[model samples]
Target: MPGFSKILIANRGEIACRIQRTAQALGYRTVAVFSDADADALHVHMADEAVHIGPAPVQQSYLNIPAIIDAARRTGADAIHPGYGFLSENPGFALACQHAGITFIGPSPEAIELMGSKRLSKIAMIAAGVPCILGYQGAEQDDVTLTREAERIGYPLMIKASAGGGGRGMRLVHTASDLLAQIRTARSEALHGFGSDELILEQALIDPRHVEVQLFGDQHGNLIYLGERDCSIQRRHQKVIEEAPCPVMTVELRQAMGEAALKAGRAVNYVGAGTVEFLLDARGQFYFLEMNTRLQVEHPVTELITGLDLVAWQLAVAEGQPLPLRQEQVQLNGHAMEVRLYAEDPARDFLPQTGRITAWEPATQSGVRIDHGLIEGQSISPFYDPLLGKLIAHGATREEARRKLLRAVQDSVLLGVQSNQRVLANLLDHPQFISGEFSTGFIPRNFADHSCLRPQVPSDAELAIAAALFYQASAQVHPASLAGWRNNASVPLHYRLGLEDQAWSVELNAMPGEVYRIQIASRSLELKIIECDGHWATLVIDGVRTRHAYRLEAGQLCLFTRPGSLRLTDRTQALVSSQVSISSGTLKAPMDGAIVDVLVSEGSVVSKGQLLVVLEAMKMEHPLKSGIDGVLKRLQVRVGDQVKNRQILLEVE
Candidate 1:
């Protein structure tokens, strides 16, 4: 049994919960470690034992090697499972675990270090006879050398950080004119983000499908590939939608890719779950992209098709077991699709959101599965990734899976915070996506006009429903006996509702038979509340009846309907406060984050669209740009200062 009994999961959120489930099912006790922010998280309560590592920040807790090692020691956990982020791919952390005599449920540190660098790994893969893209991996990092290599690799090549992944420190240079500038910028980002400025160049594939073959190995020197996944739909180089059995895959192509992936694993002597990613072009040619030395966030799609528990496999392999199945014994069946549910507003540049969960109802169906750790009253802070969970569906056919996933997305309800649910549904329903003819450029190209995720005003119909709910929840009005039984005219009640930057004036009049007439601008609506139990409501508006969910919290109305989740404020008879306006050239923190860099000082002349400050939040850096040509008037923040959302950082005048 590898002499390890209880396992400690050195992660949080969905992945931590996921690992705990598999470990406990395999007759192993599990320990959970968390930061201050996750004190009451679902994963913490689900563990057999829990420990506090540090504060909410990653560096002080999740990535703190000594703290994690101490937690494992304190809880007597002999094995540690790093769930695909933070220190999962870090070689130093794995080496530390080895020094502490703890089992790191992943590849060897030598393999992690070798694969962590794109340059070194490319050299290794090439030596192992794996097909790779033509690129530059020389040790000389001078601008002249990079520029010359860019010319040799041709225009439209990629400048990527050798030590970076997940879209950081990477750029696409389309012309020789922008090559040097892009190179310097990528270098600076890589130096700051990954502590290394080494860069690599690769010729960009215009519209290749991002596919990866999953490989598993054990202690007895065995390895196998478990099919491939299509990760074509992406935004900012981060995958959004993933599925098993790429629509464009052929049996011959799969075999070739599988063999190539096996070679990659054998080169590193890998001994755990790893992924070899590749770019597949239209001409049936493929090139190795990189290797992920840990389990992927999209591993569930692979599990769904192959009927295997990947986490279970990881546990067994860590316990010094042999390969579960050989190459010829593996089989894939049915079709599966998955979507990453995020706590972000699609209309507002995908800004991460933070708020308490007023309502949480996940859809349940025969073939639909949702993996999340959410509570109705839980507060989602801005301390980590905005990924709430994933919703995956499996069916006999692709269309069937697509239909079930779409319905699952629409039927599920999450309120009190913004999410990309509507945009995900729109992507699934797109004609190109339904036909499986999209590539990695699908989101940006199709959404150039912002038809789907643009900021939208609430329609009169939506407004009517919100007003009715607000009126009922106010508890100050009893209109059953005060109907329109006056002499000739009926008196009306007025209210003002605000959505985003738009507001409207509404008038409601109680009429006969408990019917209410709502008027806003030029249109009027006849609305009747059939039944409502505080949260879920059945309403009939304009001769149409439907059921939906709504909640009133902190003087705001949040609705979850077929259109999408919308939050509205009832500004009727409330005191107003002065605040900083966006048009005033005041740069405020978009979300809760620390100011990592202040590009300019006070009184510095700046032009519109100039990058002024870089705010680090949720494991990403956001360069705040100047909106007006003016001198910086007042600087309220400096590097390393943590600020809140909408808090003023600097002012320009």
Candidate 2:
């Protein structure tokens, strides 16, 4: 079989770049398709050829099957690689590629259609002798029928969209009263997310370990399983951390699960890369979840352990080749782990954050790999998934791998946008995780206090250094005043800075030879500047020398230290009027998104915590609630209105 001369990647970001790297290495010219927003994206520049698809929204760009196929046709590419998301699992996209005479590097269209619906997939799995959860996957999808089914299944059941993944369109109903509302919400999200409102109900498995097996197949009917990955460390039913060779998976259990996954794959004539997910209970029993018919986000950990390039295998299988290795021949070596670094705030219910990445620095070390699509000054839009990149580490043992990954995460520096880096580090360091005694509910159960997500306050020495740098920077702008110096020599230079929500007032007394005596609150300290350069400052505080990365932007100063990044607003020149608080009666949008629904109207009386509006952003719905008991005085926004961050949407009295 001959390899494709050119391969078009029908995705963006890190996964697209990842596939292009492997395809190009195998002598295949790579083509990239991008939206208007991604014209200057990394993947566009990395590919041998590029084409513009459409706009920023996924429906007009990445998810536009016709536009993607047109790009492949125009580029004369013989093959298309749908990297993980977007149209990766759409059977219609696969059929379109077949009609366009371009090879779709994944499972067959028949297999994808068979596994696309959770209900249908569960039926097929039962027929193949795979154990499935006890629930209702019937064809009756009406509200009455679903409500009855929920009652029959009892409380504590899950309402899952038949066509959904990544936690979207999923709701856990623990009571009778919440069933109907949750069903409606799930259906609405399902329609928006997967283009289908169909759903399924399952018995909520509490704190089960999410274990999935990576499988590969070819046209020749050969299939092999590539060990298993534990994806139980998750939030909102979405995976955050994944590790290969599950800690508790004995050799016997591994063989049993691997065979069952292979059985599931062969039942649907699965081809190329696919994953069979299962829910492993505490009693050692495992039940089939769903099959993902494409390469997964956590494939890198499996690749690292097996020492095989899964992308290369995907390409090879797409060329009508047989399995290169049999089941007995495949082997898993040392442990490997990967953590997804998303642009989200863990403290604020993990709300997705979008802004410019003013500073970006990744860990560079042997055995540690950083797969990302970030660049300094890049804008993180709210139009796509929040996943920025992945950080993976491999070692001879699990302990070594965890240690290396933790260190790498600590050393990483990302500024201007809130991230889950500190949260990840804390989770890894938790006693439960270190002992491998956690489950899908680990985050909510253990870290609900938000202690792990709290930001570290700067030390006194660091604060003194920041003040000294501020003084020096102020002096550089105006050379005539000798900055912060007074001829009277009796008064101290006063400066005010704000860090997060806390404000600090500092009085610095300039001394001879670039040294200063600084007083913050009641504490006094000494700091000496050894050197000053652009974004880098070397300071000596109390005879300790340290180098820090600093950036000044829009009346604010950011200091990047080993503990983490500190953003301080320079409020010295601002008037008291500028510090006014938001009006108590006004409710603002927390992030940029479109209004999905308005639950309340003007003149309506509402209590605290009453749902007022639903805003959809980053493909998830966020319900904005009334902060206090009051009457709705003004409803400023309606359904379908696009809102900006902190934009007022309603007013109460």
Q: Evaluated with lDDT, which candidate comes out highest? A: 1
Task: Write the residue-wise lDDT of candidate 2 on 330-398 in tens digits.
Answer: 989999999999888776778898887888788898899888888787888878888999999999999
In each prediction, how many residue pairs overlap at the backbone (N, C-alpha, C within less than 3 A)?
Answer: 0, 0
User: Which residue pairs show collisions in model 1?
Assistant: none
Stretches off by above 4 angstroms in model 2 are 454-459, 483-491, 561-564, 578-583
* Residue-pair clash count for candidate 1: 0
The 0-to-1 C-alpha lDDT of every candidate, in the order given, reads 0.89, 0.88
Q: Give the TM-score of candidate 1.
A: 0.96
